[model samples]
Target chain A: MDFEDFYATSKDACLRAVMATVGSRQLAEETVAEAFARAWASWPKLSAHPAPRAWIVRTALNVHVSWWRRWRREVPAVEWTDPIQPPPDDDLPDPRLMAALRTLPPRQRQVIALRIFLDLDTETTARTLGIAPGTVTAHLARATAALRACLAPTTGQE
Target chain B: MTQDLHALVREEFQRVRLTDTLDDVTARGLRVRRRRRSGSVLSAVFALALASGVALSLPPGRAEPDSVRLAAWSVRTEPDGTLQIVIRDLADPDGLTAELKRAGVPALIEFKEVEAVTEPGRLAPHCADDGEVRSPLLLSVMVRPTGTDKRAWAIRPDAMPPGTSMHFVIFSVRDAAGKSYESVHMSLVDGDPVPCRSVS
Candidate 1:
């Protein structure tokens, strides 16, 4: 697909997927924008990937991890808090679910984001994340169970 | 239960929109492409020079002063009045900035520590721009890699617009594995200088 078309169709989904993983809309938007710019630079190579959307999401997550590390070092530990805020718009995700997702380890959140939001299959997700398929499955299982546990009260399940 | 959980999580994000226009994104992408192309050209030239053992020769009867050679960097005025700067390390940014000014190029230099994964060739986040157009400033400077931890820059002071200065932000990137390297971004600013915010 032409870059314009790919960007037009995938931009929102990519933003939503990255926002789901990072739990910060502003950061997600910035990260996804950068990732898409990078994809544009390497369009020929990226266009051939099994899952270009997954590539965009993975790149965004990587950017977030880098930012988080720098922020962690510069800021005091006591000042660190979950950055998850209630969606400012009605169409955005629930703040409670975002908070729960943020509680997962970074890898688990990434696995769930790729699997559910980007809709990458196990092998494709593993390739994009540089993890083995078995590991991806393990992370997905653990993350799903934890999210379910956290949301059980809202779901009316004991 | 797993399917239900996945559905719930997916539903939450289904309606979120990026709001940024494609034109904006593509404009940023074009900048990225230009930056990458410049880097690639420099790398290709450096490789060819190394393979051919090419060296720069000074012009005979040149009145230029002897080049200032230091452990961290070297600066020399080319015969055509351009400044050739080779940076081996990021030490003594203030001294280097002073030397560049003395050599007749208006310049400011800063070194910052950032995440190793930070993308190269992008302007440092701390530096602010004056929002003025600077096509002339872009044409006045050229940078190429000289070695593993070194870079060579050629700046034409005459080509720079009056009241404009070259601001160089050299990032010191250290990965989790303790390996580190330096990358630089040079920008042209018009009018009064904008000081970079403290990263601390």
Candidate 2:
């Protein structure tokens, strides 16, 4: 697909996927927008990829990581315990789930993002994250178990 | 239960939408492309200058007319022997250091990729803060911003104490809007000082 068509179709999904991972709608918007801009800059090569959406998500996450590293170095004393900001819209994901997701190690949150939001297979998630397939399974299992425990009372699941 | 969890995630995220338009993305993409192009061109120019050996043969005591101005940085020597250094970009720290040394100032220039720190502690990676080395005379060699994007330092070699050398650690950070800013920490080191470990 052309750049415009691809952006039109995938922008919302990409934004939601990034928001789920970052736990902040504003940061997710900026990160995903920047990633899409990068995708546009290299559309010729990126359009031919097997999973351009995955590439966008991965790029967004990488951008966030870079920014976070810089921020951490600049402000070493401040703790980044709270990443989840209140969503502007009430229809957004449950705050408890987001808090739980934010508490997971970055790798686990990334695995959940790829598997649940992007719906990528184990091998694809592994490739996107640069981790082993077995490691991907392990992270997804741990993340899911943690989220289930957090949501058990509301979901009525043991 | 797994399927249910996945469905819940998908359902909730479906409500989130991106408010930015395609035109916005395209505009930002053009900016990114332009920055990349300019960076590559600067690298090529630096490489050519280094390959020509012009950067090494800069004469002592006075800055050459051509060597006085560069796209990334400039170094000039005043009649009284004070060296003026204006940095526009942090691309070639080695060349800058060489130029400073040629101008008769014992100098170590390091362009490090570090963000500005609000808290007071270590300034750069692998470089320790030595409170003993700081002196009132070193204040004369500090770099200050002359413009919005340019920072200039004036160094009086005569005022520098014996057995002392100037060390400049430049830190660069890009804001969320993609504009780059630089901060410099100047110190007077005694004898030979160890190089700051590179973190870029």
- For candidate 1, what is the lDDT? 0.71
> Which digits, one per residue and each the tens of the lDDT, describe model 2 over residues B68-156?
33446777777887777767666677787788878777778877775433445534343544432544456554432221123556778
Error of 1 at A70 (Å): 5.3
lDDT of 2 by residue, A1-158 (tens): 99999999889888888887888887788789889999999999999998898999999888887766544443111122433445576757777778878888988988888888777899999999999999999999898889888888978843
Docking class of 2: acceptable
Error of 1 at B66 (Å): 30
Each candidate structure's TM-score, on Cα atoms with residue i matched to residue i, is 0.58, 0.61
By lDDT, the best candidate is 2
Candidate 2 regions with alpha-carbon error over 4 angstroms? A75-87, B55-200
Question: Native-contact fraction for each model?
Answer: 0.54, 0.52
